[model samples]
Target: MLYITGTPIGNLDDMSYRAVSTLAAVDEILCEDTRTTRKLTNHFEITTPLRSYHDFNKETATEEIIEELKAGKSFALVTDAGMPVISDPGFELVSRLQDESLDYTVIPAASAFTMALVASGIPSYEFTYFGFLPKSNQKRQEKLTEILHHRKTAVIYESPHRMKQLLKDLVKFDPKRLVSISREITKKFEQHERKTANELLHMMDKEIPLKGEFVVIIEGYEEETVNFTGTAKDHVSELVNEGMRPKDAIKLVSELRGMKKQHVYDEFHK
Candidate 1:
């Protein structure tokens, strides 16, 4: 049997009893970083040996792990922090285990996103978890635009180094949008700041620390009821006549009409 366990995101005390016992019982533990996992194991006095299984060695490690599983060796998979397969490794191995008809169980524990979301005080009725934005500036902007248009709350992970840039992009896309920035969750110096995108940009260097992993929770776009009677093209043309650029006009009309920008652009251009 394979155990997919969740480790603490920051606070070591968050580790579950079942998770600790499972790790102790397993013949071997697969870890994203053996050195990191070793600290946890040492703290709990767990003697289970750990083997490296990260993105760099995933392909080769999966084959070897599967063979061991075939030979009736039980193993527990864990990431450096939080749940395995959640913005972390373990998906590929889980898929292979399923294909081979191997049994596996998840030992549930704290997840950073969930902690951040609940702490954010944002509407939790419905939300979309966007693990992390693309590294490229263009791709990141496109994703921010897409998130801006999302009707439900959105959650995203980002590193400290890029936090300021992300805040700037958010301000550029929609300055008034509400956001919650959380960092060092469950740690002694953990912090959460709720503010508008524009406010966050101003607070970036002055107030917010750029020192730890961050979770950004953005409030959803609230649609307004605009009583424009003209067709989409007519609305676009009117905006363009009112000094708005054609592309900007199309975007505004699309948002007002709850239609795709590309569709509005095509209609206006044609």
Candidate 2:
């Protein structure tokens, strides 16, 4: 059986007893970084041999691990922090294991996004977790636009260096949109600051220090009443007249009026 384990994001005390036992008992431990995992193992007195299984070597490591599992050897997969296969390595291995009817169980522990959501005091009843944005500027902006369209809370994991740039992009879209920034989670200097994009941009370096990994929780897009004199079909026609594609116009009308896309399409065609 393979074990999918979760490690403490920062605080070692957050490690679960089951996770410790699983790591200790496994024939071998596969980790993103042996050095990072060593700290945890040393603290818990778990001497399971750690093998590198990161993004760089996941393909080959996965095949080798699968063979070992097939040979009746148990292994535990862990990331440097938090849960495995969540914006981290181990997903492909798990999928392959499923195909081969290999058994695996999760040893759940703390996650930065969940911790940030609770700390942010945002409505967590409905939310989306976007682990990390694209590194390229164009792709990142495109993703930001998608996030702007979502009406539920959105959570994003960002590094300290990019935090300011992210806030600047948010300010460009919706200056007054409420957002919560949580950093250094489970650590002594942890912080959760709630403010608007514009406000937060200004507060950077002044109130919020860029030191550790950041989890940004953005409030849902608040739909404002858009006054228009015509029906949905007419709205689509106007946008179409303005050189928008029929399909694009239909989508725009549906989004703007909070109506179903099919309903708008039918009205536009009628």
RMSD, one per candidate, in order:
4.5, 4.0
What is the TM-score of each predicted model, taking all chains together? Answer: 0.86, 0.86
Q: How many pairs of residues collide in each model?
A: 0, 0
Q: RMSD (Cα, Å) of candidate 2?
A: 4.0
In model 1, the Cα lDDT at residue 72 comes to 94
lDDT per residue (tens digit) for residues 194-266 in model 2 = 9889999999988999889999999987656224567988887765554456787688679878899999999
Error of 2 at 8 (Å): 0.6
State each model's CA lDDT, in order: 0.87, 0.87
Model 2, CA-based lDDT: 0.87
